[model samples]
Target: MAGRRRTKHRKLVDKIKEDQRVSSVPDEQNSAAADLPTELLERILSPLDLRNNIRAAAVCKSWQAVATSVRKSNRHPWLMICPKVGNSYDFYDPGQRETYSLDLPELKDSRICHAKDGWLLLSKARTRRIFFFSPYTLELIKLPKLQSVHEAIVFTAAPTSDNCIVFTVNHVNPMAVAVSTCRPGDDAWTTIIFENQLPFVSGICTKIVFSKGRFYCLSEPGWLGVYNTNNGIWAVLSVPPPKCTEYLPPDYWWKGKYMAEFNGDIFVVYTCGAVNPFVYKLDETKQVWVEMRSLGGMTFFANFLSSHVRVDLKGKMRDNVYFSKVLYYGKRCVTYSVDRDRYYPRKQLYDWGEEDPFQSVWIEPPEDA
Candidate 1:
């Protein structure tokens, strides 16, 4: 009786295995897709914008299967020039490790800023006409033009997560302040205007920059204005280090080299051929301005406006206060990144040997993944 029961159990197991094998079938589409060269396939898809690239992947089972795999790649994010082509774009995704280009409607000729999240700010690089969209969602938002802004250049001074675009406008004069952004569903640039003469009467045309949550600008009148983004008001109230009575022409300031923001604070380096350059910090909470001190941890910021070290658009750090580099220079037109941060000290992010700065270096937005 025991032998007969064992035989019956063995037979049952064999039958189950047979049935399972018969039920499964091969996916021909996926199998065929696996045969194509991935580089060739990516080259085919790489020109599409963030939106239609997904759409092309959804075309057929074979293409979809291949495209799906392409989308999963983890590429490092990079900063690249944005192109407005074919009434659309063929952007390269540094994060994908490979690029797939797709169509972006209504973006032709509109200037584009860096990609953030999945969205791009589309605008006339010179005028205020602007729009925003996510290449993944195919959602487009139009913005209201700043009535006061007749012409402008887009500046991404806000935090990486914010979609708002800022620019200095010629409006009627080419040097006023203007801001615009797409608030979710809005279809156009929502323009904001700021105007007030410099407070103390200095001759510099200071450009506005965003650090933390405040907008800072040193006007031609030699006054620094701190505008709070949340409140939309200028606290142009505090004044420190009075301007010299010896009057210099307004053009003398030459739009001070951008104030670099690091670890949530702003530091503007003063480097000209004429005056001993010093960095000043704004204590927005207390409404006061103070020069960064050498002993108090900010000493590398030493260059005067009267020296050759101060050129058209060049600067350096005098200490570790701005990420710890303590020194940097513009050799190929690009300001070498010198992280004063305690980690890597003055490591080169990009290098071009013996090249004229006119063709080699440029300031750029930090890449966001």
Candidate 2:
């Protein structure tokens, strides 16, 4: 009886141990054993960035269909210009939950600006190489040698009668307006140089802008000029009211800006602790410029110390998202954005970093609000 009881006890313990071992196994393994169907894969791949979506499509047939459809719809994809981190800019397409990281092996110590019509201009300060990126389809165009001076090179593309863009480079003290073409991957950059010396390279950012195939320039002590690209003609522009840049009543916070463009028209917003910013327009028919009415009243810097506006447009801007560097994050530059009343402001966006993002523009993530 005792032997029989001992054997029964051993059997009970062995059964208990087996049950414990089986229960200890992970649930994920069992779920994986069932295998993911096509429905699950579709759910997983959508909502990624543009670059990633492209790669995912190449993996198989089913994924390819999803990526192609999202791209065809023309939804805006988030583009990131990170060089030291790795090669190529990271394009994130939220419409399709996917990311495509294109390889840019030539990018070393390069600074990148906004992407216009899929081509992004990258300037490497050293050897003067312009690596172009077709951010949409991962197409890259490497340009030939050009002047790699200290001045930051800005990029803009437009559709015109000639169907080519004018590439202009300017420093703080505007020197010569060096013009290049709209072709991103071209080696030959022909110059339509400015004949005159740029007045102020040391003072604030004196600049020249192109709008509707017409180029307009801003100089010191309230000087503005317009350039015609088609005929290579140039002329002077009128001035806004001069301000007392010396004294501030301690109640005002305004930093004046020369005429900036919003939707192919010229505008200048003056500040002397005043919020009623004014705008001017280039009357295309009259061949003259006219100062429009005050836009919105008194706007000041939120930090109360630095007042700078670095303006650029975002995706298909019908004057919608206007990008600015209003929020400086303890670096040489800060970025911020605001909406203009009744004005179709293009993308005025900014992306700031903890350290001096060097000259790279920082765009804020959408959910920060």
TM-score of each: 0.40, 0.45
How well does model 1 score by local distance difference test? 0.42
lDDT of 1 by residue, 201-296 (tens): 312234455566665555454456665667766545556532331222345444333344445555555433243334556565775555554423
Residue lDDT tens for model 2, 74-100: 223232436457666543332232444
Question: How many residue pairs clash in all the candidates, one count each?
Answer: 55, 49
Q: For candidate 2, which ten residues in a row score worst on lDDT?
A: 299-308
Candidate maximizing lDDT: 2
Where does the lowest 10-residue lDDT sum fall in candidate 1? 303-312
Model number with the top TM-score? 2
- Model 1: runs farther than 4 Å from truth? 1-122, 125-127, 131-144, 150-184, 188-206, 241-250, 274-277, 285-288, 293-369
- Model 1, residue 130: distance off in Å is 2.7
